[model samples]
Target: MAKSKNFLLLISLLAFFPLCFSSKTIGGYLYPQFYDHSCPKAQEIVKSIVAKAVAKEARMAASLLRLHFHDCFVKGCDASVLLDGSGSIITEKISNPNRNSARGFEVLDEIKDALEKECPHTVSCADILTLAARHSTVLTGGPSWEVPLGRRDSRGASLSGSNNDIPAPNNTFETILTKFKRQGLNIVDLVALSGSHTIGNARCTSFRQRLYNQTGNGRPDYTIDQSFAAQLRRRCPRSGGDQNLFFLDFVSPTKFDNSYFKNLLAYKGLLNSDQVLLTKNQQAMELVKQYAENQELFFVQFAKSMIKMGNISPLTGSRGEIRKNCRKINS
Candidate 1:
């Protein structure tokens, strides 16, 4: 009898472990076990699809991760970024920050489809996006954390909010920090979240100004190494190749690591938004140096900051609906 009681107690404790990381929102709590009963295989389905996608195209990991960031920044991870324009809806996909960029939608659709078939109207697209981001990070050799689930998809997309809210590559450090602050993130979150650049690519157009005319002075930005600038200019050029791709972290570009911070220290950061983390603010510079020196510390903070960012203004309880199609609200 004693042995049986002890075994049951241990099982109960194990089952309750995920609830420890639950995040509280205005409507209700979001716990990791949100679908343990309703959709027992929800996370497994998402992870499998994300793994297949990332295995096929390593860049897909970063693109999926970026989708979560872009989604949360605009409307709090409500899948607003996934919506297409129809009637009253205006797609955020065509916004300045996302147009010609922001990929991995088909991968998301694949995950959502599998999820819907497994459990109809049970898992939310918002939750799928959140899980995909976490899976993508882990797939690219980054840390993982328990993502609180139970989020719902928004009924509409925000084009204006998408354009103005998402940080632009050319924005000054202050502007970027302010944008993050508006999302309830802080300086530490800014530096840590920016570390996501460790595993992504940037367009030539995103940083051409720094290579050719950083301040419209018709001269290269001296902040960048002359040799590196010359190499970038060859591909980026003064006129065309706007869509040319460059690794955000030239060293270990496909791996999620602190090399991005080290690149910033060496002035090799691919985007102006990236280099400014070190040059434009003393505090952010210190963070860059710390992360460059300590990969473990960067990983720990990256996981925490990601969870914090994921918790921004989620729709819970009776707030939002679980959309049948990720691209449109339920009719």
Candidate 2:
């Protein structure tokens, strides 16, 4: 009778509860979701900031812009990625301090000078990072994901909070899928936006797996292609490795085109997460083909993916503060 009663209770609980309420698994990895009710005006002000930054440091605007997008995409536009990953690390997972690039701070200062002049404290540097991310995509010759504005700055950046938030770059397809689904994004978006990897730079420490892993020796059921495999292995070799290897185009590293996907199709994608696109699903395979052949297809999907990615871990409705500098929160 007790067993029967317990079974009934278990069923009742499962039936009555919402799935998300079941656990914080999805959330512990996403950025806060803040509603940007005031995104348009904020976007315009941000656009002006980009223009100013471009006027001063034309060569670097695209990179700074990419920085913000990268942060938002990884853990929503929470600006947490702008910090020390908020200390978001998975068990046995390596931490990537991509945001810690001094290059990011260098461009951020230029943007601060511009925003302070036009909007002053009226605009938060957090919003500036979000807007700058969108503009940077456009500047990079990719589609602009429409950014909703007015995300107030986070009051406290818990390196602890961040540590549990961002996804691991070296994760498996299942791991990446679970992480993305938590943020309301799906596998298709994951594979598509990951094509952005085609143009970015990374340290071998981030992607040494595909290089040193056993399957990459060119076996069936191996994650990626051999030529691409050999290339990454060469960079982060069992022998002494070189750090300047770009994950983007072996042909044209800086151009934001389909080469990343093209490389993945060839098994040349730099990261293990990247090679998973080919093995993740037949649908992802189709996307790789479409994106490689049709630039517009890649653009449209990338824009949608960016918007979805940004919505993760947001700071909606008085959740966070608007800081004077993006690097640090306002007291």
Candidate 3:
């Protein structure tokens, strides 16, 4: 009888203690159990769809991961990135960082359709993106964490925020750090979150400036590995092939691991922003070395930073609506 009473007290503590579960609120409460009773199969459905998509195309995992990042950085993980231009909304898909990039919207539509069939407006598109991102990491050989759900869909999209807020591949280290800080992320979060590049692809256009004229000079950036630069140039060229695909990490590109940090130590990081983590600041450089030396540390920090990033200014309580369709606002 005494043990039963203690168990009930422990349960009560968990029910009230947000930090114990890492479900602290910013603008509103978002907890992992938000849909446990309402839509018990919500997470299962997201994982199954994300796994199928990733199995179909290994790159799909990376694309879905990026979708969550792009969404959160702009209007706080509200699924505003999913909105198509209609009425007063301006589409973010055409933004510089997203144009010809940011694939996997059709995959999201399929997930939403499945959820609607099962639960019918019980889950938010924002939650779907967040859950899909965590699943993507796991499917791609990365760590998993409990996603705090209950985020809502935005009624409008931000084209300017998408363009200005998302850091470019060639952005200076300070510029990238500044952009992350604007989103309430710190230096550690910036370095850890940037590790998402471990499993993605980048366009030739995104890093071409370094290959040809890094500082308006005729030579390639000396910071890059010579043989690697030659290989990149064979496909990238000086002009054209802007849409050509290149792995962000040449070694283990599709697997989320410490290879990205190792590539930086070797001066083979695919993007200027990547290498700058080593060159630009002493602290970030130490972080790169630490992650390169310890995959477990990177995984832990990456999960924590992802949770922090997902918590940015969420619309909860009564602010936004859970759209029946992810792409349009409800009338």
Clashing pairs for model 3 are none
TM-score of each: 0.92, 0.72, 0.92
Badly placed stretches (over 4 Å) of model 3 are 1-27, 217-220
TM-score for model 3?
0.92
Worst 10-residue stretch by lDDT in candidate 3?
Answer: 11-20
lDDT scores of the candidates, listed in order = 0.88, 0.58, 0.87
Question: Model 2 over residues 166-241: C-alpha lDDT tens digits?
Answer: 4555766788777677777787787776777655566666666656664444544366666666756655776555
Comparing 1 with 2 on TM-score, the higher-scoring candidate is: 1
lDDT of 1: 0.88
Ranking the candidates on lDDT from highest down gives: 1, 3, 2
Q: Candidate 1 residues 54-158, lDDT tens each?
A: 999999999999999999999788999999899989999999999999999999899889988999999999999999999999899887777778899899899
Shift in Å, residue 162, candidate 2 = 3.6
Off by over 4 Å in 1: 1-23, 217-219
**lDDT, residue 129, model 3:** 95
Q: Give the TM-score of candidate 1.
A: 0.92
The reply for model 2, stretches above 4 Å from the true place, is: 1-66, 73-76, 83-103, 214-221, 239-242
lDDT for predicted candidate 2 compared with the true structure: 0.58
- The pairs that clash in candidate 1 are 72-77
